[model samples]
Target: MLIIEGLTRRYGDRIAVDDVCLEVPRGSFVGVIGRSGAGKSTLLRMVNRLADPSAGRILWEGRDVTALQGRALRDWRARCAMVFQQFNLSGRLDVLTNVLVGRLNAVPAHRSLLRLWSAEDRAIALSALERFDIGELAAQRAEHLSGGQQQRVAIARALVQEPDIILADEPIASLDPRNTRVVMDALARINREFGITVLCNLHALDIARAYCDRLVGLSAGRLVFDGPPEALDAAAARELYGLEADEAVDHAPALPGPTPQVAPFALHA
Candidate 1:
């Protein structure tokens, strides 16, 4: 289990994430929802130590992640992989090579810097690409692929990390509806089939409700709600978004219920 206790982050005098606490069970799919500056990204980054906490503790299993340093911290980060809003791929590199980068944690530093990957490593990278049905694009430059495909490549790269937990920070924020579905489906598949724990930060309530087993709502850097999607009624939506439920819906596009299908636009609300 992943335990967060009184987690807090502050910059100057402004608090970004305020005394937040949560428990994420093994193999569960969780969605963190909030407005753009509501500290969703800050909270997720703290999990992998991308952003350091000002106070409190983050414990995975029983070890305090906040206290780890050097090689220990490196190992912690590898075990807890992260996916970003902008697909963090090397545009000049081929898809396969980019995916192979995930193996850097396991390979010797000199070998990785030289781009010398073993045959077994190459095979593993190919398998990860195939998992996302992009094996044919292995030889193509990452920049040449479509946005959805690039995002899938990002996921494939994360898979090669062999992480126990995946923290996706607004991974679908930049995608069109169709691409969003594709990425979400891949994440769901990874969670269900591989039993990897996933904590995704999302903007759309519809997408969160459809895909996540549990929903966590944050507003102004403080958690406001935590429950199943079905429990997020109109009143809760209003509370979470700081707008009337109907107003929130009016600002957001109607999204299809959770399924392996695609639409055309993204819903920011």
Candidate 2:
């Protein structure tokens, strides 16, 4: 189980994530939903240790993730891989090489710097690509793939990490409706077939409801609701998004426009 206790992040006086607490069970698919500045992304970044919390603790199993540093922190990150909104792949690199980057922590620095991957490592990376139905694209440049395919390559790369948890931060925000469904379905498959814990930050309530086993609603950085998707009624939606019941329909897109300004550390993904 992953336990978050009184987790908080602040930018001088403003609290981006305030006193949030929750427990995530193993092999569960969780969706973290909110408006642009509601701290959904901040919370996930903290979990992955990409951003440090101003206060509180994140406990995975029995260890405090907030306190890890150096090699320990690197190992922790390897176990908890992140999938970003931008699909963070080396566009110039071939698909196979991009996927193989996930093994950086396990491979020796010298070998990785020289791009010398072992046959087993190459096979593993190829298998991950095949799992996502993109093995044929392994020889192509990552930049040449379509948005849906690039996102799938990103997922394949995450799978190569053999992570216990995958933190997807607004992964579908930039994709079209069709690609959105494809990416979301891939995440669902990973969670269900591989039993990897998934914590996805999403803007669409309909997608969250359809894909996540549990929903966590954040409003102005405070966790307002935690329950099964069926329990996120109109009233709960209103409380979470500050919207009228009619505007809180499952298909309603997140409020469009510039996201509210957050701390610089929290903006990178």
Number of clashing pairs per prediction, in order? 0, 0
lDDT of each: 0.87, 0.87
Candidate 1 lDDT over residue span 1-269, tens digit each: 99999999999999999999999999999999877788999999999999999988999999999999999999988889999989999999999999999889989999999999999888888888877788899999999999999999999888888888999999998899888888988899778767889999988887888889999998888999999989999888888787634433322333333433222111111
Q: What's the lDDT for residue 25 in model 1?
A: 95
Question: How far is 66's C-alpha from truth in model 1 (Å)?
Answer: 0.3
How close to the true structure is residue 219 of candidate 2, measured as C-alpha lDDT? Answer: 94
* Residue 219 displacement (Å), model 2: 0.5
Residue pairs that clash (backbone atoms under 3 angstroms), model 1:
none
Highest TM-score model number: 1
**Candidate 2 residue-wise lDDT, 1-269, digit = tens:** 99999999999999999999999999999999888899999999999999999999999998999999999999999889999999999999999999999989889999999999999888888877877678899999999998888989998888888888999999998888778877887788778767889999987788888888899999999999999999998788888877633443446333223323321111011
Where is model 2 more than 4 Å wrong at Cα? 244-269
Span of ten consecutive residues with least summed lDDT in model 1 = 260-269
Q: What's the TM-score of each model vs. the native?
A: 0.92, 0.91
How does model 2 fare in lDDT? 0.87
